[model samples]
Target chain A: MLKKRIIPCLDIKDNRTVKGINFENIVDAGDPIELAQRYVLEGADELVFLDITATQEKRKTLTELVRKIAAEINIPFTVGGGINSLEDAKAIIESGADKISVNSAAILNPELITEISKQYGNQCVVVAIDTKFVNGEWMVFRSGGKISTGLKAVDWAKKAADLGAGEILLTSMNNDGTRAGFACEITKQISEAVSIPVIASGGAGTREHFAEVFQETNATGALAASVFHFGQIPIPELKNYLKTQNIPIRI
Target chain B: MIAILKYNAGNVTSVENAVQNLGYSTIVTDDVKALRSADKVIFPGVGEASSAMKYLKEKGLDQVIRALTQPVLGICLGMQLMCDSSEEGETEGLGIFDAKVLKFPATALVPQMGWNNFTSLKGKLFDGINLENDCYFVHSYYAEICPDTVAVTDYILPFSAALQKNNFYATQFHPEKSAKIGLQILNNFLKL
Candidate 1:
């Protein structure tokens, strides 16, 4: 049986893990490799690094950081944020990222999804969609969720899959950072709509939240940042919790 | 020394990094001589089959790979190309493994791209790795179970997770991308 994956997301800024900037639980938690190594020891199935770099030079720094971490860790690692073209994707992949995720770029040009997937296999192209419930419907947002794309989340997910996206990283803005759990209703919609795997992101509070998302939706994986970063939810404890709940979590 | 077989397939760089992470130096080369002289040859790829087979034939890597006697590990697409043939391209493979790589039926979600556990492990690859050890797999096609199959993973159906025959061993999953247990698997392969 395919196990439900638990992915700890690291938000990178200027090549350092910034997601843990406010994480007071772990000492010096900003070190990407150290936290990633700890996560591996705790049995994290995979890792995602969201590179929120601002400039081209900083992007280079991010790739260097990717290389540094990839050299130390031996897990599935994905790099996202600011990757818009094949060259960008190639740079990151060469830097040792297993897959590259695109959000606003894919929305602006859906063909970019197919184009990248063709060069690199579809298995390496993850299209992330940020959706917010607006006016009673889940609408897609781009440009760091500041601008609405006016596209339906479920419909765009199907389109992205049609465009050769291997997987969908669906993050619900309404539930993001709220610790209210994942947007299961939309997650199930997209998962059912696409043939590829769907990774549920955004709201992950308790270990039970991970269980709730898995139980309610066919999400292949669940991703969270601060909770795990702050040591509030250690990955091993979460895995054991999920196992007791009858979830097919990786141990 | 490790020679990472290069035929322009993707993931060669990452594999080299993984090898180095395990404290082994590797050279990414298509030269048959470099491959022959290496202590171990790692054949890792991430790409479609038909075209990759085309490139391999054009460069004669297909033959060079088949003639390897030392322990050669094939990963993902590299593992598929080690079979007799692949349904992905209807292209003839190296025939190292008596199996066929077929696309996952449309009835199930393809690529099955994530971490999955292994069962029925009976080889050096799983040494120090638990029976229920999970590895990252990202492929649309899979090599069917054959007499050489040492491990099996059930996704849509039971497929060959790991295959070993004589000096040729291949894993349908990416050990390089599968964390500590994955590193342990590679360490075992290196010791072999």
Candidate 2:
């Protein structure tokens, strides 16, 4: 059976991992490669490197950092943030990343998803949709969850799937950094609407929160940043808790 | 010398780079002469089986590859093509290994992409490797475990990770994308 994955997301800026509070007041976490290796040893099922700094200088530095980290880690790693063109995706994939996540670039040109899927297989492309609730409806946000696209979360997810995105990484801005819990309603809706796997991101406080996400939503994986980073919830312990909850895990 | 069979598939450069990183000479070729004369033949592919096999047949490299007696390693789609048949294009395979590559049934999840571990490893390819060490994989179809099964990984079902028959060896995962342990496996195969 395909087990649910536990992913630790690292936001990289200028070759260093920067963790922010509600996407602001960024603080350096340490070297990207060392942090990634630590997550791998802590039983992280996979790693997500989101290069938050979208400048040209940061892009080159991030690419080189991805190469160094890819050379070290044995498990699959995903690189995202400022992936605008096929060349960008190809460069990162060639640098040893197993998959590429696209957000702003994907929304700006939806056809980019199709082109990438055609070139690198659908499995190599992941569409990351950051959603924020507005007027009692979840709307898609771009540029690190700041600019709202006004596109409904479920509709955008369906469109992304139709555009050939293999998986959907749905993050709820309302729940992000709150550590309250996952946006189960949004996650369940999107998961039910798409045939591909859905990874629920944002708002995870405890191990039971993970279990609730798995049980309440049809998500195939759950992603968290501070909870896993600040030692709030250890990955192995969370997996054990999920296992006891009868949720299938890799352990 | 390692000859990585090129068929317009992805990940060819990565494999070639890995070989070069290990201080081994590698040639990315579709030519029959270049492939047959090489010390080791590597069938590296990262695309649909039907289209790739089409290119292989078009160049008449399939016949040349099947005739080679030297050690041959197939990665991802290369491994699927070496089996008896594949459901990808409903196309016949090289029959190098007595196994069939079948598509994963459309369950909750279709493509088993990401890192998965190998167990029950056998043969020289897995030398100095530990069980449960995860390797990167990105595929929908899997080569079923058979008499040639050397290593196994689980997703929707337990499937062959590595398979060996005589001098022919294949892995469903992308060793090139799998980092160090992957490099170790590739190094082991190169040494073989």
Candidate 3:
């Protein structure tokens, strides 16, 4: 059986682990390498590093960080943010990251998804969609959920899959940092709408929130930042909880 | 030397790093001479089958790989290319394994991403690894079960999770990305 994945997302700013709530109020978490190794030790299924670095000059630093992490960490990890071109994707990939995720770049140029997918197989390309519930609908947001793209979340996910995205990282801005729960309604819609795997992100408070996302939607992965970083919900404990709930999980 | 065959495919860097972490020297190369002379050859790849095959043929790696006598381990797309054919692009494979690769039906997700366990394990490659231990897998097409199948995994359906025949060993899963269990599998291969 394919087990549901518990992903710990590390928002990297200036090469340090940070947590952004509702796409604002960034706070220091810990060292990425130490946190990554700890997650692997705790049996995290995978990891996601979103480089929130603002400058183009410091983009090279992420590649170095990716290299150090890839050299030390054993599990699969995806690196996103500040990747605007195929060359940028290539740098991260060559640095040894398993996958390179694209968000705003893909929305700005939907062809960027295809380009990365072509250069490095779709299996290595993750399309991250930041979405927010607006006017009774889930709309796509870009630039770290700071701007709306005006595209429907479900529609964008389907389009991304068709564009050759191997996976969809669906993060809900409304639920983000709230620790309320995942956006199961929109998650179900997007997961069902795409053929590729969907990783639900944002608003993961307790172990039950992870269970709810897995059970209520077809999401294969549930990603959280502060919950895992602050030790609010430990991964092993969460996996045990899921297993008891009859959800297939890797322990 | 453990030579990781590189023919414009992706993931060679990760594989190289994994092998080095296991205390084995590795070289990422397309050099026919280097691959043939290496103690073991690790053919790691992540890309479309047809395009990959085209690149291999262009680089003359197709023929060199077929003639290699050393233990050659293939991972993911590399495993698919070791088979007879793939439905991915109606691509012809290296014919090392008498099996065909086909895409998972829409009954489940197209790409079976995440960790999945293996069953009916056989051969030295799985020596230390526990039976049915989960390993990372991320692929849409799978090699159909055949005589070469040493291990099987059930996703949308039962398929070859790992295959072995003579000196050619292949895994549909990404051992390098599968955490400790994956590292054990790689170590097993290196020792073999």
Question: What value does the lDDT take at residue A164 in candidate 1?
Answer: 89
Structure candidate 2, residue pairs in collision: none
- Considering only N, C-alpha and C atoms within 3 Å, which residue pairs clash in candidate 1? A74-B179
What C-alpha lDDT does candidate 3 achieve relative to the native structure? Answer: 0.91
Candidate with the greatest lDDT versus the true structure: 3
Error of 2 at A18 (Å): 0.5
**Which stretches of candidate 1 lie above 4 Å from their native place?**
A20-29
Docking class of 3: high
Evaluate every candidate with DockQ and list the scores: 0.77, 0.38, 0.84
Candidate 3 clashes between residue pairs 3 or more apart in a chain or in different chains: none
Q: What's each prediction's TM-score?
A: 0.96, 0.87, 0.97
Per-residue lDDT tens digits for candidate 2, residues B1-192, read: 899987866766567777878889989887778888899999988778888888888888788889999999999999999999999989998999999999998774678866678667888999998776667787899999999999998877889999999999999988876667788999999999
Estimate, for each residue in B48-158, the C-alpha lDDT of model 1 and write its tens digit: 888989999999888888888999999988999999999986998889999999888877789887788876788878877766878888888889999999999988888
Interface RMSD of each: 1.3, 3.3, 1.0
Candidate 3 Cα RMSD after full superposition onto the native fold (Å): 1.3
Question: Candidate 1 - CAPRI tier?
Answer: medium
lDDT of 1 by residue, A133-238 (tens): 9989999999778799999999999999999899999989887777888999999999989999999998899999999999999898999988998889988999
Show model 2 residue runs off by greater than 4 Å: A56-58, B1-3, B12-40, B115-136, B144-147, B150-160, B175-192
Local error of candidate 1 at residue B172 (angstroms): 0.4
